[model samples]
Target: MSRSAGRSARSEDSAPSDPDARSNGPRIGSDISSNFPDGGQASAGGASLDRAGAKDAPAATIASDSRSNPRNSDPRDILLDALRAALDAVGGYRSVHRRLMQEASIEGPCAAFAVGKASAFMMAGALDALGDRIEKGLVITRHGYAAEVIEPGWPVEVVESSHPLPDASSIEAGRALIDFLRRLPPRTTLLAMISGGASALVERLAAGFGAEDLARVNRYLLGSGYPIGTINRVRKRISLIKAGRLANFIASQEVLNLLISDVPGDDPKVIGSGLLIPHTAADIDTGEIDLPPWLTTMARSAPDLPPAKTMDSIRSEIIARPADARAAAAACLRKAGFDIIEHPEILQGDAVEAGSRIGRMIALAAPATVHLWVGETTVRLPPHPGRGGRCQSLALAAAREIAGKTGAYLLAAGTDGSDGPGEVAGALVDAGSIDRGQSAAPGSCPDRSLRAADAGTWLEACGDLVRTGPTGTNVMDLIIALRARSPASTERSFHAG
Candidate 1:
């Protein structure tokens, strides 16, 4: 694979020099109306919450026209508000601080290790709540996501690595994690802040496995279109640190896991491939998933790891989840006078198919209703795929379904502010998105892009891509749709223009 393949466009160089500057974070609620091809509609902004002050801050302010012309408001603005609300509910700084403060027994010298996309934010929170009690700290995060929240003279070490795929630095991080655990004195309280993307950010392979083998297996599973649960199950089988095996090295008296769930059921075992959580009987079974011959052989031949020691000193809690984000989003829309129709079931299965189904549903549904769906979607990549993630693919597919229809708009995005391998969070599609894309690249077909898994390229041409940088949280994916009120009822109903 090429160096640029599956890498985020936003490099660390693009990040602001002063980590303390609020502008260094995502541009939440920024006016980006000109980015869209369709004039008047604003592109969705990112989560605006200030990590340094989130503990005492209210929810990030969402830009809205509810007091002025609610009817003429942009669906993108409404979607942006919902996104902001979702982030507020699951914001790492607030959630981690609140959880730590509630634990009365958690005192004395502590060691902290925060890993994954939300590492910086979560680490900052831990530092705040524990203060001088935290004697040592480690932060393993995705590249370009390093935030300097650690105070001077602190013993905290930060390492940036790869994500959605593992690289050499991932291996280094894995070894460092084990060393960090081994060096801690017995009886020290260990605070483990685990979140989404931990699986790829750090790993200690089994004895027989090499970095190449790990990368190849991960690439295959990612392109296989399997759900995250299945992928994580396979991961646990191959890692020395995953599937609670990391517990083997802990010298601490108490292990506290504070997580921000990105999986379907919010299973800690599945989140980050269960770095400290054990696998159940169900987790051991791969179910009906048919593994490729190479993977099957590897699994059969892999050395068995010693069972993780069960300890009563360990405690785990899910501080934030997809449901929390969805509920918060629903509340924001409801406050804006739109009727809500939230899907009770999690959205799963193929991304393209889900988008088509949702697009048709929203186009035929009653007006003045905001339809909301939350869940992660999968994409089966071709031999060689193009630039895009599941959210972009879903958005483009939806654009095909709603072509020529008026007053219909949809937004599909990952809560992490990254969709697949790109820097942009996701995409927002209107009824005319297909035509706009085709016009931008004459003779281009949306179907071809979908088939090639190149929806990001086409979405960019259409001016439909939504970029939010790092969102400081990860729950799962969110989908929001709006159908305008009928002309006859326009005077009485609140609708996005």
Candidate 2:
């Protein structure tokens, strides 16, 4: 088949059968739905424009209610609920609002630009804190983030864009951001609210490069099993706004960069591609980053790399991190009487290997023990791999390790609420998951699915997948490991939710 014909065929085959599937691009059926319900207006402090057009709308208010709080005593329910609280505590709008309110006010009118999974909430917090002091702002977030209408007098403009990969919407968002920044005066303060998905949500193409090229590069890097820092360094080298380029453009303006970190080190330079933090000469000289030949060439040849900024106008702080999330989980589990086992190092490397290793550790641990870990995992996808994400695959691999063992359970999920291309967040797996997989298809095994990177298919058949839609936050993945009561013990094991 011709290349174009092959591409068309693949696209057709991967089209979602579900009516509610997110249409960011053609991809196979996955458990997680990216088409989340729109978060209603985060703040009613100012007037605004509808995303579909520049028409007037009523100002909106941000509700403080959260979806987590469970009434059941189920261990899974408690664990998941605790996670929600953790996410809320770290990435919640109230925290950002409080922080902004406490900080010394900007001298003149300020402009805020928020980008990522938590963009709406973060932007809302800025508005509530800054009030009429913020003359105008822009928010570039994932699809479905801007579903509600804003009040007529609100000044911020919200744009929904593709995430984890750049699409047409991403291109438009990038153009909008660049245009907005270009119009600001040198003395105007710029407040950038950044989180995990900003790397893909906002972009400005280098000269002679198109969105397709950028998308292709991102896909290759995502599936390469390389760490995010490596992927972002290459990304920074190829764009006009990344690696502190945006800060360089503001020239002499005070820039306050607030972040809810989703990366391991919580380094602002890697977060949101370091939009407001310029890389120093020493940083460029530090330890090498290995990438594919094509990516290296593109990184080297890309036009308009951000020149190192010497001004001291930029300041940054991490509002949240994985440690904070893990701490919350530990506190919650301890309250429930489970002895928590915390791993010091952030989990890393391939999904299957990591999951298998962690699963074995949990299985052999003492009864009533809870193991918690946080970090991102990578999967090397096979050609046309079936629906599944790194977290799902990790859970499946862990399932295989704990097969036939009673009371062994694992909950693996992304805090952002969507994992990979699926509508579901991740999965909750136990010994029964293996039993269901075996009964669903004779001779079908988690090993086979793991090999194919098709864990979601097998997991769905086992009824082990977990879904929470979009939680309006992203801080990497969280894993909960628990062992059942000893055979002679009287205590009850954690029941799945």
Largest TM-score belongs to which candidate? 1
Candidate number of the best lDDT:
1
Span of 10 residues, lowest total lDDT, candidate 1: 1-10
Q: In candidate 1, what are the lDDT values of residues 1-497, reduced to their tens digit? A: 11132012113343322222322111233222212111122112222222222222213432332322434355566667677677767867657866776777777888999998888778766765666677799999998775434334456789888887798788889999999999988889899999899988999876666778887987898688887668877877667788777888887778998889988878787888778876665565554669887777666554454355554567888998888988989998888777999887899989999999989988887777888888988887898999899999998988888898787888888877788776878888888899889899999998999899999999999888876556567888989888866655655445334
Q: What is the lDDT of residue 40 in candidate 1?
A: 22
Local distance difference test, candidate 2? 0.68
- lDDT, each prediction: 0.73, 0.68
